[model samples]
Target: MNLISCAALAAALCISVHAAAAAPVKIVAAENFYADVARQIGGAHVQVTSILNNPDQDPHLFEASPSVGRALTHAKIVVYNGADYDPWMDKLLSASKASDRRTIVTGQLAHKQSGDNPHLWYDPSVMPLVAKELATTLEASDPPNAQDYAKNLQSFLAALKPIDARIKAIKAKYASTPVTATEPVFGYMAKALGLDMRNEHFQLSVMNDTEPSASDTAAFESDLRNHAVKLFIYNSQASDGAATRMLALAKQSGVPVLGVTETAPAGKSFQRWMLNELAAVEKALAH
Candidate 1:
């Protein structure tokens, strides 16, 4: 082989290495929760992006913009809650026709079909599964950094162990404790903590953003007046007039209120925000 041929081969190899190192794996997360998990598992190898980050807006009613479509079109992997919660992503994915892109749907992970609750992230068991799946998918997409991806997944799972332990402790401490909420957003977490929830009708109605019937409202008011629930979990994102009224009634009855956010609020890390919310619930129960 000539010297020039050897130099050309070396340059090509260097170019290939540089390309692999410079190219970031693009990930599109339909919700903020998935975005957080993706970041934890992907670390510096993946660029995780989320469409829904507004704590004040209802995720169910989210409308996709041109930028979202473009993101979906270019994403190497996508994560979404599939129980008709982020149906906009479904439409965008279908329209974009990116068959090669890997997609993970949390509802499918839970074996739930349409109309089922889409808030799967609140379940303590879901995050590890999602992280593992994400790591696997990222490994498949970018084989050059498979070891890094695995290491990140292991670190994230290790960190999550204590969070799960904390949840179990709360459950043991508050077994069968009575709680109430304006919406079913926190039902999974509450159930995991073994908190018995009252005012289901009001929760479901508010969750669907439909007006509660007169009888349902009256029943919820009676429950509040009678102090039927020890703690009131208020959804800060979509608090309707009914929820506001319920909050007032809970205050009058001396029931402690724990405010919950549907999305990670401004200036808070995902795990910190969740821990803070759970701590608030614990405080309310303690009081």
Candidate 2:
């Protein structure tokens, strides 16, 4: 090729490379599941960061810092579990207001209020709304790659089909099964599976970080001791003293225990994480 033609091609290649690198949308999620979902929807066009990403730790105990504040301020789009689930995220957003920032609250999409269950990720319908909102926000952020974002959203939705079918299958197989928990972390999924989840007062008390009433505690203990429930679903991440005691009692009673979580486990996609947890419940129920 002629020298002039070679130089022109090299310059064009550099511009193309720079444009490709700049196409990604900056996104931040308060929790990892939402980040995973956003990543599924945004695909190669979005760069995502999650603040509460430790699957081994309780997200409710997250301590915010200056770095978190900077992340919120710098992100073009941010997602958080609202209804007081991550009030710190709200505080960060309030403090880090920007003209083009888009904030998505998963709880609000699920129509949750302050006193309502904050574990909205367990609800089947939450992420669909989140994915839609995220795609719209991402399209606006990177108009040149809007079609890619839309296509990724469709792909993510299609991928969820098997997970949804599995959930239905489990619900059908274990409809109206008796169960109990230390907290309401898996309450939505339990309801979907048609479980007669007992000890609401105790679960709510634990979730609200308060002491369960004597009657509530007695009922929980009685249920565990007598095998009144077939399964005990515990939040392994939030195992406080009461939860630890309940876990021991449940194990002693021979009722199978299923551990659920607020964060996605290490090396799991959001869909895979949920399916695995449901499979655990299924395995426990099969006995």
Candidate 3:
């Protein structure tokens, strides 16, 4: 090849490599739901690593590993649900001491406290706020692609309108329906749909890995046996024996049980996952 041809080819290759390396932002999320939202907003300009992506894994019992710490330490942006939900992540972030890293705590953004419900992602309003914060962070990190991030943020916020509508629709049709869960995994969403959540003490006991008092257990069983609740929501990822027994009782009593996961399922978006669960609840109550 001629000298001119070789020089031109090398210059083009260098530009391609530089662009590839420079075009994207690096993000690490403690949960897959936030990671999915980041992916939607960042699109092709972000690489997201979600530590808790397994639906079968109990998020309540998660422990930090060296590799996870390394990822957080090196990440340009780290997103996690705070409010004592994932305290290990806070420790990791503090240990890393990354002055420039952008951290978006969805729990804190929603005014959630340490004793409040830790599952902020399930709340419809939380992600949109997180998405907006993420867009701002991404734009600050990658000014060259700021417009793309802004457009993506708007699209994501717009997409959530349908989910909100579905929640309103469920409220219109099935509001005030009695429901209970082995854990309060769906508590926020249930409240949004106006579900009368019963057995609060039992659910909270199971959530905290403490044994439910005999009285609370009896009340839960009684609610199931008497068909007082229309739907039973189960955190399919939790491993408590009390929750398991409650599930069996729920089945035997013919109460419709719905399985919910802590993280988004593989190949599903955050909006899609929420809608799917809401659809299930609506269907169970439709009968």
Clashing pairs in 2: none
The residue-by-residue lDDT of candidate 3 on 31-128, one tens digit each, is 99899999999999999999998898888888888999888877999999998888898788888988889899988789887778788877887888
**Which regions of candidate 2 deviate over 4 angstroms?**
1-21
Q: What's model 3's TM-score?
A: 0.92
Taken over the whole model, the C-alpha lDDT of each candidate is 0.84, 0.88, 0.90
- Best model per lDDT: 3
* C-alpha RMSD values across all candidates: 2.0, 3.3, 3.2
- 1 or 2: which has the higher lDDT? 2
TM-score of 1: 0.93
Model 2 CA RMSD to the hidden true structure, in angstroms: 3.3
TM-score of each: 0.93, 0.92, 0.92
